[model samples]
Target: MTGYDDKPWLAAYPPGRPPHLRRAFSTALDMFDAAVRSAPDAAAIHYFDRSLRWAEVDRAAEAVASLLIARGFAPGDRLALCLQNNPAFVVGLVAAWKAGGTAVSLSPMSTEADLARSFAAFTPSALLVLDDLYVDRIRPILDTGDTGVAVVVTTSGLDGQTEDDPRIFADVDRRRPADTVDLAALVDAHLPGPGVLAALAQRRVGPSDVAVLAATSGTTGPAKGAQLTHANLAFSAQVYLDWSGLAPGEPVLGLAPVFHVTGLVGGVCLAMIAASPLVLTHRFEPAVIAAAAARRRPVFCAAVITAYIALADSPDVDAADLASLRLRYSGGAPIDPDVADRLEERLGGYIHNIYGQTETTSPSHAVPPGTRAPIDPDSGVLSVGVPVFDTVVRVIDDDGADLPVGEIGELVTTGPQVIPGYWHDPVATADAFIGGALRTGDVGFMDADGWFYVVDRKKDQINAAGYKVWPSEVERLLAGHPDVEEAAVIGIPDEYRGETVKAFVVPRPGSTLDVDAVIAYCRANLTAYKYPREVEMVAALPRTATGKVLRRALR
Candidate 1:
């Protein structure tokens, strides 16, 4: 018997909300099929000035699926997709599933080393890369002849968009690689013939089949892949739909990166489940997103708090441009109550807090639509809302004993949305999931009324603009430099971004370390968000008697 057994949060559920899902699709593919069947002519994707109907998307996915199978992409094979929030990403995701392959989500911002580490962790059989990314990142890897990737399909970010906004697309390379197959050409072929349909029919995807290998923060080590099955994706999508009460045919704004779990499930899968149009602006350019919102009149958007802060601060974006957003949810990082209030005042919508991890597929806790999240009086931290449908959240002590209400401890959760295990890593899987519940390294507590508030992390991980940036990873990268004797990284508060990476370094005996050069070195090696934005030259990092760096002391 634990404090969570009584389910105190149910009392606060929105009127007419069910404790469990009333209905859910067996898989994401099933959900996509249902949407196409219900609204063939409804807008499925709105990219820039172009809108692709449900039927159009279905046809394109089917054609691409056929092309994939013809290229020897077998069942259970993994298809690595490195792209931004574009129409092809949507088409490629459905196509991967339809062709009986697992979709591996890879960040477009990943550097060569980052990509190499990810590839080593999960070997993909086929790769769908954006043109510029192909030229800069993928081509070099292919030249090394190390990866098992057999089929290389490339596409341009300019595909399906009639108006190429110079803010995003002006520098985009539309050139197709001579060695790789063009995704646009495959869709143009429209080869979903009887043979292709028969192939798809033979390879039926079940709920238990892995849908996406979402990457997690390599806080302990290299970024591990959380194997989110079709069931996980389907249930998580339904939770978003029901918790938010997003109406059918309403446009869902795609402000988060599609490569991320938050954007994949909340933005893409949620839109598919609701039969809503997914409004995208290539990537998350605030001015462009504001313009799209004004034109499309999108009512729902689930993005990081940083994105909301940026959108609200953009001089080009006025309240009128964002007046259409009614269901705004922010997750991936802690939200400031003052920032939320000011954003609401400026944007005219409550910034509902949604909480989850890559292991949970997307969201396990979210503020109910039309309800305001409460702030913890003692800590002044805003609650991350209560557990969603069919979820059990409990706070436990170091020995795994259940903690009383309002006592800060590690948050352990078990839900339909939680992943079964990490892909190809049994040791991590065993360590993370204990007694059928995920031992989320997050430290938080649940109030008596069932509002949950996160206080800190059990690990030394930094959440910069909702992207996980581990200090160890940054420290290791810094230690690789010739001029650095030792380094330590920490996260510092930023007015706009929720947190930014800051590094403290010790120089070699005689070597002079230029601060700008050190920062530029990290910027060149690591992803934009992972690199340290601020660097300080220090004589030594505060350490304990055991010779371990005390990050809290540095903080």
Candidate 2:
């Protein structure tokens, strides 16, 4: 932020400004430092009805960073952040960077076994956790392990102390005064000693050093941490900031956690770089988030499609304030057009489908309004946008052959935005990177205009009577039905057709749902081979941590 603020990467972004390529000070520490300078007293985070201003967050992060340095913890020490969305999470993130260490994200709700696996793979020097369920689960997991994890801190209950050792510090109220050892004071107290702050000012971390280790959010597999360098996070944050037309100091509604790339980069890190204010929610609640969205009058709100749908249906929805919102972004799962149409009508905002995964650091492509992909309602929903700036997207066959435009194939992506590889998972890493491109298991295609459309997965595609059908196409079609609350599609074996298209529909609380009626609706919208041959109603769809629906769980 100091030496290369004028670089190309930091150039005028948003509304399609060029990328910022800072040779110096691309580290997350400098980004947070700049935020502290730009909006020192503005609210940086608001969660659980508690707020922390930029100045406060900056000092807090600094204090935490200095604490690590004073303890002789040098740069590159991995710190596992296993807490939920809170001011402490941000404090820990910046603190790690300020101390020249990388913050590795751990899912808020990892099982004991999952935590153990992560600890062994990354071998982080410390683990920061919440006390109640999170820390409790992790403590037991470590008790069973032989690895020497040096630091363990709990933010869940920051009481002076009960009985924990090797803690960085206990929690203290940012407004309270006491010898109370909390993270804020920890960083501030350590900032001036041992030339740490001066070294921080110089900014040693950049494109080469790993900035974050984010876990994969794919369903049906063990999560793998993605080693993202400083350049990866910086480039991703810069691209999203530019393409979305978001302005500096814009108000961003934060729901995603630091554990996910989208949540961390777009939700937190982007806000830091732009000095944008944030309205926080510990966990997503449809009505709660909608009420806050209305009151906050945020510039941009990004989350999954379900959250958008819930906001539109919320009784407390203030369509007017939401109307002031510049853009609404959705990721995690493909957007149901019905949801998009409803949001446009209620909030007067474009329904943008941001295509991304944890591996890419967030999103690159977004389908803005006025660009509608062809509505097959049978084949699949077309992704109505081109690749993000400087990013390349391709469709390829199994053998890595380039498929002609408009033909279905595996979606492969390559760019500065793409992740290098999965951390410690050599086999998965090798299989994931095909021909220098990250092989997104997603099955999609590119149109003549170079727009990408996600159909289904190679694993999810259904073949019935030798005809290929995509589940997303049928699910989107049923989403338009009034009685259908939610839908998922899968395939079942059929004696006559070899395979038959099957649909799982979650209906309105009291609405009567019949497979015949739903199939009749798809019949009106889809081709003969694409229509669902069987339909079953369900209560809810299984979802992953990032809120992506798990279609594989279909009955």
Where does candidate 1 clash, by residue pair?
Answer: none
RMSD of each: 9.6, 6.9
Q: Which stretches of candidate 1 lie over 4 Å from their true place?
A: 219-221, 461-555
What C-alpha lDDT values do all the predictions have? 0.86, 0.70
Give Cα distance to truth, residue 555, candidate 1, Å.
10
Stretches > 4 Å off in candidate 2: 1-25, 48-50, 70-74, 157-191, 194-203, 368-384, 493-498, 515-534
